[model samples]
Target: MTTSSSYPDIDAQADLMVYLVLSQLLMRHLTGRWLTVQHVVESTHLWLLTNGGSVDWLQRISLGSRAQELAEEVAQIEGITFDVRTLEAAFSGYQHLNHRSPAVAAIYGACVAFVVERRTAGSRTGSEK
Candidate 1:
């Protein structure tokens, strides 16, 4: 009989699971005004530590494509339109930040920047009355 521990990619799978949970929590928090970038980063770090993982492990693993897919799924479930490429870019940017900041903060910053840019562009186009 084969045991679950025998799986070669078990750690990766567990990390992905944790990412999914984090994504859900983030989505819920995004709807409220009290969720700051600092909160997101701190919460993410705490979650990782409690889940038997670390920021180093998260930074080392590449989950860009999977993250994009998960974002799409969450967006659909929440009835929101999300640009998967923007999310992909956020993850890409986080990877290149070189430990300067937490992944959640980097991604949240990118997302906020995107939203602000979109609002600015919309105003310029007179899309918002």
Candidate 2:
């Protein structure tokens, strides 16, 4: 898919949607408290550790599949072709980041920073072409 000012590609859009889904799920589980991205990531890390590190199990218990379906619909409404696998991979990768670092919040924060940097660089390059 074409990159836009808002998203670098469909995969990035899907990743954002998956993040939103997880954030919403965490918010509901915490009784509607406000949450930052770090809070969601850390909570998800703890939850995965407690629940056998199975993304499929999380999906089953938390309506994650349904949320992905909804995200796909939203993408279609926006005229972008959506792949369910992109969301699935993003969700799994987000959870997997916890495994890469002992400092729970740090890894997620770094990952977000890296992605933002890459996207910003890409956009600048594209605009200069």
Candidate 3:
């Protein structure tokens, strides 16, 4: 289903986006094929450990069929241009500076940056400036 506005809904689905991107990244590191539960789990753990985030969040999550379903949906959202590798790099570096993994926050930040910049660029008046 399409969302109210691509921007806000993309923000809402940020978590799934990150996980999906992580899935792709992990796939590249692993077998370079389809993602499985093991791939998701390993990716999640690796991201947490290397990014210096607590592993406690894993307790509340399950990298099962449902996650794969959500990931597919989020990854297919129209008009969203995400470079999974670029996001991976940015997310990795962001953690070093902030002392925490950006996690879904990275997705939200990118959306915000895009919307703000787009609005400013397309504005007819200097009010947006």
Task: Give per-residue CA lDDT, model 2, range 76-116, as digits (tens).
Answer: 33322223333333344544323322222332343345446
- Residue 126 lDDT (model 1): 69
Off by over 4 Å in 3: 1-21, 25-33, 53-65, 82-129
Clashing pairs in 2: none
lDDT of 1 by residue, 21-105 (tens): 2344345545533334454455455445545453244432333223434443444433233343333333333222222224434
How many Å off is the CA of 126 in candidate 1?
43
By lDDT, rank the candidates, best first.
3, 2, 1
lDDT of 3 at 115: 38
Best lDDT among the predictions, by candidate number: 3
* TM-score, prediction 2: 0.26
* Model 3 lDDT per residue over 74-108, tens place: 44555544355443543545322221444344444
Kindly indicate the candidate among 1 and 2 with the higher lDDT.
2
Error of 1 at 56 (Å): 0.7
Q: Give the TM-score of candidate 1.
A: 0.29
TM agreement with the true structure for every prediction? 0.29, 0.26, 0.40
Better of 2 and 3 by TM-score: 3
